[model samples]
Target: MASAIKRSRTSFLTALSLGLLSFGISSCNGAWRQRIGIEKQPVAEPLPEVSDGPRSAPLKPGDNVIVEAVDRVGPAVVRIDTLKRVASPLGNLFGGRAPIQKQAGQGSGFITRSDGLIFTNAHVVEGADQVSVTLPDGRSFSGRVLGGDPLTDVAVVRVVADKLPVAPLGNSNDLKPGEWAIAIGNPLGLNNTVTAGIISAVDRTNAVGEGQRVPYIQTDAAVNPGNSGGPLINASGQVIGINTAIRQAPGAGLSFAIPINLAKRIAQQIISTGQASHPFIGVRLQSLTPQLAKEINATIDLCKVPELNGVLVIEVVENSPAAEAGIKPCDLIRDVNGTEVKDPSQVQLAVDRGRVGEAMPIVVERDGERLTLNVTPEELPRQQ
Candidate 1:
């Protein structure tokens, strides 16, 4: 009876041990499967919930805005492909117009008025023997030079079109720095290309032309060779300026445009009067800097006689308006009309706004003596 009881106990112990071993094996396998992500159930963490918030604004692009403008004004914009036959000096000396060599150049223009009056840069069609405009619609028209003002680098060309889309004109006086700007033209002969940027600056006066100084609107819009005469439009698609010049260097995005205000005035005069008159003060001026005052044997007090910041007359044209008004060398011009002159540039700008045959008040300091002279403004000759 004792032997049988012992046997039963041994059998129970063996069964219990087997059951424990089976549980241990199962736990080890489960852990391995979970670590390796091989279980029927997911072993990885759940993803975080996403919120429905607005996305951030994108960075402003330099080329895309201009491209957009080009798209908007596509039909109105035209390519001026011109063939200029230069009279070869040798051919001119040898007589017979040597088989005219075709020289091609590209420029851009926008239809300003509904009558098909296109405005472009003067340099584009300066001496072209034949000028033709190509539209985005694949239509072509013979263009005639209505008028050109080289001083302002603006020109008017006429084309025959039944109906035309005109670009909206913007007031340049209202253009401010940091506003959006776009340039559209046939840059590098690529028709209807647009370049975008901001008005990096405004009223820039570093431009030199025909031995004269011009205040220009500076922008960073990537203007290239073919962009000359193209429209620089604001966000509202209004023409703000006419793209004219660009610095020819990589990363040198310094480009200039003729203010639409000035261009519009010149264009109107060109279309109606056949010529535009630019006001000019018949005198060469040197800014009244300390060094300049010293060089001219003038004192700061005497230099201040003009009641302006800049130096006065360096040379006055004989019998010219300045001389006629008793303005002489060493005479400090303090003001024009009623505007105070800050520098030669400001004086020139003020003079440019005046019309020919108008009388402008000139306040000058001569030998430390203040004098008010009523100078009769004269129409500068077209040649000047």
Candidate 2:
């Protein structure tokens, strides 16, 4: 969600339904895609024909896209096992278990580089005392965590092996909602599990967590525990997204994946610098519709909103980039970097893409006057 992506400015007022995987990853379940209930799943919709963009080809009636995609990328998927030291109260008392017992966790990941570099979720290797990476060919290696960006839930783990199988990363920006989505992972300790569905949505953002900034891809593909950090490939047999977490709606639990576009950017940084930087210009935003604008004007007396549909700047964080740029409360954000932003998510996406210390120009309307402001984004505070 935008709330989790690079200090994304908040727009929604309601609580998000997503259960972020950074906390209490149960051993029975893995990390990211635990199943609350599967028998109660909603009926699947009819499958629509999809194009693979540049790789689009005519599909024969007997052509199995899932099998084809798996054959191409399955060898690169790996099972990750973590051993964390946990403090136990029954520290060898009365023949009980010893103190600081070893807690094990299971999750999935894929090799993104030929030089033993692996891509996985931050939660998977966050507190692990030791990480064991097992390949499909029965090869295991002790993994070293290069770094992890918890705000984005992206991490990079490297092994000493050479010439690893690399899964091809696709352009997530080219993914359409109706395109075929194939998930390959180790779910519920089932290694090399494959699931097929369609891409339900893309650019899925909202309040997921306080500091997590992930443009999640929504899919009907089943993701259970131990599926975290696995690749959600496209029909072209390319990694379009990384199966991250699930958000439970009414009767169904919607599986979500982090877009490869965002994941690759964060992953590259982790590979190079062992840490990631998230640019932030702190400002609380709320998308305003015509009816919402009328209500705000009628009730809110602090500042009257302009008669336009755009993102309304609610609160400019103190000493933030928005404050340094003289952005004020009740300002209607109209444009950023020559692009008109109608929703808070768009603004968040723009700000997230901006490089740290770069001067980003913004246009906001206050009292019907359009004022252009130059905001120099800074690294988000690490505490959050």
Candidate 3:
């Protein structure tokens, strides 16, 4: 009986071990199938498309500012076309009688008054037999050159139109570097082209040429050919300068504009007197270089100072403001209206800021003594 009982227990133990082994093999096979990706994964349902209606993203603050400025100032910008006569080179080769050639040129301008008064660079309409002004609205009219100042390169034109859009003039003296600048003009024959940039510099003295009297505003704006005479506007859409000349070199990124304050003064003079005249102190002045100072010190013995830092009066015009104010040749100009000046251009700029018949205080070093003299400037005589 004991043997039979023992045999039954052994059989049960063996059966239980086989059952566990079978279960382990089934689990391993299942895991292997999953690891090899033989087992299929449940498919995910497709999501519905999101809809937000037809509205687009709002413009950024900078974009809004630019758009506002353009809308405000675009209508005042005008296209200027000039017709002039030129002598053909081929005709000159044929005979002494050269054939007359007609040439058309284009530039930009802005309306300054509602009665059709326009402002532009003097060179734009210089020697133009016929000037045609086209408004932004595509309306065209004949324009008459009222006046032009070549030194400042400012001109005025009058069109026979009423209720014209005019650009407001801004104070250029308030301009600062890094301020926003917008240029609206016709660049390279493209009408009403707009360019945006920042004011790179202010109070730039010499840009166009040595004779340019007005201080220039320098910018990185892309001013190309045919952009001359257009308005350089501020963020407020007011004209701060007039686009004049651009430096055309690879990677130069230099462009210049005439300050609107100076241009406005010139334009007002042209409208009132048919021409612009700058105030002068009637002295031939030259910058005091080291070599020039040495020459003057050797010859005149008046500028033998330790360090000369001012313009030297080379010649005082006879019976002029300088002579009348006791300023003589060899006198070193130290200051104008209490502003220290180092170059003759500074004196010119000071005189330009003053009105005719206005007394200007000039400080000079005469014979090792500082002398202050009051001189009333007169209008510069027009060239004969």
Instruction: Say which candidate scores most in TM-score.
Output: 2
**Stretches of candidate 3 above 4 Å error?**
1-63, 87-98, 289-303
- Tens-place lDDT per residue, model 1, 1-384, is 000111111111110000000125786798889888897654654422111112223234556554554555656778999989765656645576574566888999988766678889999998888899988788899999988888788898888875677676777997789998888889999998877889988877655442333568888888999999988888756678989998665757688999988888788788776667776557766566554444434432323233335645656666667766677666777887788876666677777777676677878788777888767667666664
What tens digits encode model 3's per-residue C-alpha lDDT throughout 1-384? 000111111111110000000125876787788889998554755422111112223224675687887877799899999999987868867576568989899999998777788989999999999999999999999999999998889999999988888777777988899998999999989999999999999877767555347789999988987889999988877788999988766866689999988887887778777898777666766666666555544555333533455676666666677677777766778888768878766777876777677677888887788988887777776776
Report how far off residue 59 is in candidate 3 (Å): 15
Candidate 2 per-residue lDDT over residues 14-133, each given as its tens digit: 211110011233634542234566234346554221112234243333567678778778998999999999988888789778777889999999987777888899998998889999
Candidate 1, clashing residue pairs? 287-311, 288-310, 288-311
Q: What is the C-alpha lDDT of each candidate?
A: 0.70, 0.77, 0.76
TM-score rank order: 2, 3, 1
Cα lDDT for residue 75, candidate 2: 92
| Candidate 3 to native Cα RMSD, angstroms | 38.0
Between prediction 1 and prediction 3, which has the larger TM-score?
3
- Candidate 1 deviant stretches above 4 angstroms: 1-72, 92-99, 208-213, 298-308
lDDT of 3 at 2: 8
